[model samples]
Target: MIFMEDVQQSQATIAMPIDRVGVKGLRLPIVVRDRESGVQHTVAQVSMSVDLPAEFKGTHMSRFVEALEHWEGTLDYHSFLTLLDDIVDRLQARSAHLRFVFPYFLRRRSPVSKAGGMMDYTCRVDGYLKDGKLTFTLGADVPVMTVCPCSKAISDEGAHSQRAEVRILTRFEGFLWLEDLIEIGERAGSCQVYSLLKREDEKYVTETAFAHPTFVEDVVREAAKGLDEHPKVTWYKVEVESFESIHNHSAFAVIESDG
Candidate 1:
């Protein structure tokens, strides 16, 4: 057998420590809990890293994949923290970070039509482990419909209504489902958008938006209010971006809680 030299074990010449060193853009299949179903399968773009000491020249990149491959359980809040622990132990590091970005689907029934369709929401699960403490943040991007209040008041014909996205990131003390955040985002808008809408559903949504005209600022404020009212949510950040139909530029607003 030939002896192979491990270059990563060598001492670093720069004498500087790296905050994070690992892999990114790793695609993996994971299962998550669904409100209606028992579980749902989805693909995730995963990124994992750990703090590197000044003595180490580099981290073992292959170890990141190795650890992720061993993760076979459902991806949930508890399991997410466990995965971070596995990475930290495998890398022999003081701190570790893990992020998974995936598209979560929810079954929706169109209003007035009773049509069923799947709605996709971009979600992210993040974990940071340091000093034996773990911090978890869950984020979701929800699409909704919004009407301009100013345009509705002056215009005699119609109002400018467009699609907007509400992004919510929250840190909670207890368990909270992704649907919880998504519902808050949807309700914050003038009207909820559906994937499939028939003629009657379209009329209903259009009338709903016109009746509850709101600005982008209103969306974030409403989302913040929902998070604030929740007892389990310790901290939260809400961002609303509207793709204006009348203008080329998009309107956006952001709000964050003190805690």
Candidate 2:
């Protein structure tokens, strides 16, 4: 075959730069360190992008996966940032972005039954690098039981309760884990949930949520308070959404601060 010119390297007449451009929704197995568990292996949906200069027509899409391979099966805060920076340098771009969304499993035992199982939390790690500075964000979605305080107070027999999730977003200067955010979220809800629960455990959780009787607003406020006090968190946002069992709509609240 005749040697062909590198089409992607050819100069563009329009010279329009893109803010972000590269691969997304890539499923790949990654190894991440867990503070308590030591190591975790999970598949992540990844998006890696680099700012395209006006001179360039396109970025080398395959380079994103090639960069991930350099991870050598492990990624932590330092390595994650380094990867983003390396991409920026390799692509000769002004900035780069990387995002990994995965299910992080946490082990939990039933409140009363003592049965144990793993529950997966929606977790995300995102990094953006520019001018030797890196801004990384850690996020998690934790599901728990929520009982409406208003329904509890008004109802004669029992209160309407449903599953709710607290999503926490944080920008930290130091190491942070999805597990830490999971704890904060679980505590803010009326009661924690378990993947495997016996009848006894179910009974306990039901009564516990009823006794707590928290609204979506309350959950967000409580989660925000916890994040605000976190020493490592430089900024934080907490959002709570409760699927109302009695109503057609869900209740939600959000709180944020720059710590």
Candidate 3:
């Protein structure tokens, strides 16, 4: 005769919540709409994240990469929203966030001779979703030539000229291309900078900027005006930074979104 002993089992315990979990600095190729042209191909550095509830100890890190792989080709407002929604659903989380930064090139025509060239602009897009509600933001860093107004006023011979970068961030209610923000920044500066410039083009840029000298503060205000008039943009922030030629420090100005 044989006998068997009874076994005891332990009770299950719940795990603690993670504050934030996701991926970062993921490089991928993407295509975006070019205002002058129809489409442009570029690479983007992307980041995605989601909030973890108090009941969950961790999130599935692999899921974020998997989601990105699916929609990494053609990126747009609609595709971005769909990706965010998928992340939220797949992770079973209340919120999801996405960020992408890329270099966008635009073909530009010379003011005088109408010579054509390409200018590269740094652009970024961010999206977030919570409780099925979504919000999207677009941004760009534009480089231009800024001739100091005060320098021009005080100096008799020549005014101080420096390279300035203007950054524009805006929340969009509808579709808006990165090129739009770039144009706003270019118009705000004394003159827009270019990647390739011949002697004639350089002369035109210098004279044009000297004729329309601007301060850092002026650039921010002007950029704000352009953003205000745009119908697709719901909110915006304009920032200008000039690399001072005389001094080591740079002059900067910022304007936040009120409308």
For TM-score, the strongest prediction is 1
Query: Between prediction 1 and prediction 2, which has the larger lDDT?
Result: 1
- Order of quality (TM-score): 1, 2, 3
Q: Tell me which residue pairs clash in candidate 2.
A: none
- Candidate 3 accuracy as TM-score: 0.88
Model 1 lDDT per residue over 33-87, tens place: 8887878999999999999999989898988888888887589877888788889
Global Cα lDDT for candidate 2 = 0.88
Tens-place lDDT digits, model 2, residues 1-259 = 9998877888987899899999998888988878777999999999999988889888888788888877665667888878887788677788999999998987889988788899999999888888888888999999989988888888799988999999999998767777789999999999999999999998999989898999898999999988887788889988899998888999899998956
TM-score of 2: 0.94
| Candidate 1 runs further than 4 Å off | none
True-vs-predicted CA distance for residue 117, candidate 1, Å? 0.7
Model 2 misplacement above 4 A: none
lDDT of 3 by residue, 1-259 (tens): 6865321112214544555679999999999887767889999999999987655546778889888877757778889999998898877789999999999987777776677887888899899898888888889999989999899999989999999999999997767878788889999999998776778888999999999999999999999999999999989988899999999899999999876
